[model samples]
Target: MKKVNYLDKFLLKVFILFVFFGSLYANDHPYIIVLGTAQDGGSPHAACKKDCCEELWDNRFLHKKVSSIAIVNPKDKKFWIIDATPDFPEQLDFLEKKTGFSLAGIFITHAHMGHYTGLLHLGREVMGSKNVPVFVMKKMKKFIESNGPWSQLVELKNIALKELSNEQFISLSTNLYIKPILVPHRDEFSETVGYQIKSKKSLIFIPDIDKWSKWSYDIRDVVQKNDYNLLDGTFYNINELPGRDMSKIPHPFIVETMELIEKDKNKVFFIHLNHTNPALKQNSLEHKNILKKGFNITKFGQKFHL
Candidate 1:
């Protein structure tokens, strides 16, 4: 039998203390998890024969869901999702399996199909969730309450709409806050807004903004204030969609956004990529360029401590 030394005992105690504090720190802070990264139509878009999506049709593993993210509090066993997308069912299941937490609530960015349409899952025919608090802006609240299918969700008590005022911070949990900042977009049904989530650190999400110049607030200032920024990357550049008018479906191209914030490129993660966007291909030159330039591309399941 080997005899244990005083030094071994001291090392054992140090290791135990490290493990104890690590667990406590993880539980004390909330984090953001990326659920999906595709645009509203999703990857391998319907009725498309483009080269970018053609290979994805046969590759089930390559499919990307609509853009969405989840915030999780391990301490309380609660989590919240931003932008209940068409992929809500799978996203919800992923969160449940990943964290085993109850959904705290959902936050919607706008009335866009990819943003708010997933509330349908909580209706009578599906989960039939009871009073699932859905946070939204003023026009968004009215849009849901007044619409047919969405109104039915409200009437059946599947969801409880909570209106959020622009730039006002709302408390989600201890040391956790969320603020909505209105942005310029094609607000056909409701106004669009970006969310700023604060925990140990802050993160900014602007997945569908039309263009940075159109907004009153400076994009560079916003990027600097937040630890992480997931901005719109619907197209790699203005020439992505040929024959189709790019002006009508405007978004700050990846190149344009990159040029805007040269210094803080490390803090930015471009997301909500369209099928035609070459950056969606991991090995493509555009994707490589993004990383080479100190910027990042958001991927499904990426976790960031907040």
Candidate 2:
């Protein structure tokens, strides 16, 4: 056996340090990525001949998917999706390619059509994903387990449901945590929740709600407390949809929400835009007004690092 020299020992130490710090430098931060910003029906909604849907029909590039987001932990090479929207397949592929991270789990907000319907893609007929952890509130868990098609996914072991209680913190990684905050909404099937994601910088995500007034907490205070906020902008105002009684389907109009948290607009990004929302069009006057007011609208591929 030959003894190692001091020069060889020093070289070995340098190699080890290079590997350690290089790994840290490459994957030290986690982030939230905006997948889609449209409402449940998505942009260019079905069977509608309105100009909002008309314009997008010819311009496929401008089409938008339903609202959803993903929290990515690069260090672990894994990520979790907030909602499994109708655009799940595309969003999942985008996340995997963009961040090089495999999906670890999913957190559903409600049993709404867009929010959880994409779970169908995980069924045996589709991805056939085995034991994918799906976090949800009690009602949502029951709804999925008891309902057809969705229930089949559970029975086939495509996804494993994990029930969450209101306001309970779920730690995702060493520096990342998420808490489900229940909010008032049309709970026909399950409860609606907004997630508070905590890391080096925190964020509040509420894609759907009846109205800010109905929530227990003040929207102003939540905006001030979080570094980033993605709240409901389902419609620009009550007038967006003509003939239909807006009261029948209540959501905080962007105008109404702006009045409440105008001061902290910089931290806010309005999302889940209805197809008829003028703000959905980048060149529309409504879009410019939101920018002028120092508020933002979520765009596909927008990223917030933690």
Summarize candidate 1's per-residue lDDT along 214-274 as a digit string, tens digits.
Answer: 9999999988888999999999998899999999999999999999996788999988999
TM-score of each: 0.96, 0.92
What would the per-residue lDDT of candidate 2 be over residues 138-183, giving only the tens digit for each residue? 9999999998989999999999999888998989989899999999
List, in order, the clash count of every candidate structure: 1, 0
**Once superposed on the true structure, which residue ranges of model 2 sit more than 4 Å away at CA?**
1-27
lDDT of each: 0.93, 0.92
| lDDT winner | 1
lDDT of the structure predicted as candidate 2: 0.92
lDDT of residue 207 for candidate 1: 95
**Candidate 2 residue pairs in clash (backbone atoms < 3 Å):** none
